[model samples]
Target: MTTHPDELAGRVLSTTQHPWRFALLVMLALELVLLVCLGAARLFLPNVPLIALDLPILLLNAIFAALLLTRLGWWRAAGFRALQRPRDLILLALPVALLIVPALVVGVDVPPFGKALALLVVTLLIAFQEEAIFRGVILHGLAPLGTLHAVLGSALLFGVIHANSLLVGRDPAFVAVQVIGSILGGVGSAALRLRFGSIWPLIALHTLNDFIQFSASQGLAVEQASPVLLIAKLGISSLMALYGFFLLRGTEMRMWPVSAQSAAAP
Candidate 1:
C-alpha cells in the first residue's frame, strides 16, 4: 500500500525534531557531498571555465538533494507554487530589485548568444542546488530551533559555503564581502520560502540575480571600478540586509501544509 504525502511529511517532521545530532550530521554530509563534487570537477576539468564545470556538478547535487527529500517524504515541502500572497511577493521584490544594482552599475557587454545562454543555464542550476540544500534541507532541519535561530543558522551555513571562493584565489577581503552578501541573501530568500511556502520564486530570483552578476563579471569592466561604485555596492548590500531583517520581523516558522487528501489519509 502507498503512503500519502502528508503521512510521509508527518514522519519527516517528527524525525527531524529529535536526535539533533543526526540532523546535524545529515546537514554536514549534504554540504560535504556538494563540496566534494565541486572539488572533483575543479580537479578533473581544470581547462573548463568554472561556470561550465559548475553546471554539471550543481545539477548532480540538485539531483542528490531531490532524492534525499523524496526519501524523507518531505518532497512537497519544496513549495514550488507560484501566485502566492501579494504582500509577501511584494516584500520579496525589494531585495530582488536591489540585487541588480551591481549589474546595472557595471553594465554588461552583449556576449555571444551561445556564451550568454550557457551562463543562464549555469545560474539556473546554481539556484536549484542552493535552494534545495540551504532552504529545503538545512532550514527544515533547523525548524525545531524556532524561526529566528533557523533563519540565522541556515544563513550562516550559506555564508560558510562561500568560503570555497578562497580556493579560487579571490582576495580575502573580497570573499569576506561576498560571504556577508550571501548571508543577507540567505535570510531574505529563506523568509520568502517560509512566507509563501514555496521555493519556486526564490529559484527564479536567484537565477536572475546570479545571471546578471555573472554576466557583468564576464562581459563588463567591474574589476577597475571606482571607489564611488564600490561604496554604492556596499550601500545597496546594506539595504538588502535591512530589507531581509524587515521581512523576517514578526515571522514565525511552521511546517508546510500538506494536501487535504494527504492530511486526511489514515
Candidate 2:
C-alpha cells in the first residue's frame, strides 16, 4: 500500500533514533551562524551599534536564505508559493495590528534617520531569515507530528533557540525576557504560517513588529528588566499567540509535507 505523504513523514519521524535531537542541533547550528556573523560584525565594523551588527547579520542570513530558496523543492515546502487563502490574510490583520502594542506601550526612541533606516533594513532581513527557518523549514519539518505537536513544538523550539544570544554578549536578564517574548511570538507566527500556508505575509508582519520593539525608547540594553515593559510584552505576545491557536484550532490533522530532499533520511 502506498503511504500518504503525511503518513510517510510520520513513519520517518517515528523510525528515527533521535529526530528531536537532530532537530535541536539544527536549530543550534543556525544560531551559531548568527553568532559568527555578529562576531564578524564586531571585528570589522567596530561600534556603530546598528550597522556593525546589522550588516554581518544581513550578509550571513541572506546568503543562507538563498541556499534554502534555490532548491525548488525546499522552497515550495517552505511556503514559498502564493497565499493559498486570501481570507486568512484578512483575518490576520487584527493580530497584526495588536502586535505593535508593546512598542507603543513601552515607547519608541526613533533613532537618527540613518540609524533608523539601518534598523529597518536589518529587521526586514531578520524577518525574512527567521520566518524562513522557523515558520517555513522547522514548521514543515515537524508537520508529521500533527497540527498541535507540529505547531506548538516548532514554536517552543523557536523560543528556546534564542538563548544562544547570551553567548554572543547579550545580557542574561535581557536574553531571558527575549526568550519569553520569542516563544510567545513563535506560537503565533507558527500558527499563522500554517493558516496562510504561505510565509511571505508573516515575514512582513514580523518585520514590522520587530522594527517597532527594537527601536523602543528605553531599549533592552537600558530596560534590563522593566516590569511594566515586560508585562506589556507578555500581554501583547500572548494575545497574538492565543489568537493564532484560535485561528488554527481544528484544522489539518497533519500535513506539513516537505520537499523531496528535506524529508529524506540522512
Candidate 3:
C-alpha cells in the first residue's frame, strides 16, 4: 500500500514547479465558492435544511470519502491500510478517552436511541469531511514544505473551522477554550498521520471523541460552568499538544513514498 516512487517524484516536482501554489489558490477559491453556495442555500432555499445529525450528514461524508478515493487512489487514500500498527490505536485511544469520560460523567439529557442516531450521523460527517479536507488534502498538499509546516498549517485551519460552532452565541471564554482544544486535537491528529502515513485511524478517533463530547453535552453530563471540567478539558488537550511536538521532533518520522525509497537504497 505504498505510493510508487515515480508517482511520488512527479507529485513533488509538480508541486515544486508551479502547480502547488496554483492548487492552493484553487482550493482557497473553491472554499470561497462553497461559502457562497452555503449562504445562498440558507437564504434562498430556506426549506432545505441541512440535517447535522441525520442521513444528510452521512451522505455528505460518503461523498467526501469518494472524492478522497478518486483523487488519491485506493492505497494512498484508504488510510486504513496504514492503521495496522498497534501504536496507532494506543495513541488515538488515550486522547479520545480523556475527551469522552468527564463529559459523560457530568451527564446529558438526550434519549438513548436519539443519541445513538445523532452520534452515527454526525460521526460520519465529521469523519469524512474533516479528515478529507484537513488530513488528506491540506496536509498532503503541504507535505513538500516539511512535516512541521504541514502539521501547523492543518491544525490552525482545523481550529478555525471548529470555532464556527460559536455562531450560536456561546461565551467568549468558552469559545476560546473549545478553539484551543481543537488546535490541540488537530495537532495530535496531524501528528498521527505523520507517524502512520494515513488518515483512517485519526478519522475514527476524531469522530469518536467528538461524538462522545456531543452526546455528553446533549445528555447534560458535561458541566460547562464547572472549573473542574474546564481544567480537565484544557489539561488533556495541552498534553496532546506537547505530545504532538515531541512526535514531530522525534527521529521516527514517517516518510512519504519518495523519502521511503531514498531510505531504502544502500
Model 1, global lDDT:
0.68
Model 3, position 6: C-alpha lDDT score? 61
Better of 1 and 2 by TM-score: 1
Q: List per-prediction Cα lDDT, in the order shown.
A: 0.68, 0.68, 0.60
Which of the numbered candidates is closest to the native, going by highest TM-score? 1
Each candidate: RMSD: 4.2, 5.7, 5.9
lDDT tens per residue, model 3, 11-56: 5546534424733653564355445545666787767643222344
Ranking by TM-score: 1, 2, 3
Which sections of candidate 1 miss by over 4 Å? 1-11, 18-23, 34-52, 168-171, 219-234, 257-266
The true-versus-predicted C-alpha distance at residue 175 of model 2, in Å, is: 1.3
The residue pairs found clashing in candidate 3 are 106-221, 107-219, 107-220, 107-221, 108-219, 108-220, 108-221, 109-219, 109-220
State the weakest 10-residue window (summed lDDT) of model 1.
219-228
Once fitted onto the true fold, the runs of candidate 3 whose alpha carbons sit more than 4 angstroms away are 1-13, 16-30, 47-65, 72-82, 108-110, 166-174, 219-232, 251-255, 258-266
lDDT of 2 by residue, 1-266 (tens): 54355554454454233445645755766777776776766687677463235456556766776664443234766777899778767966777668665465556667888878877887888888888877876676667667887788778887887776665555577678778888887888888887787889988998887777677633323335556656666777788778878878777734434434455322
Q: How many Å off is the CA of 215 in candidate 2?
A: 1.6
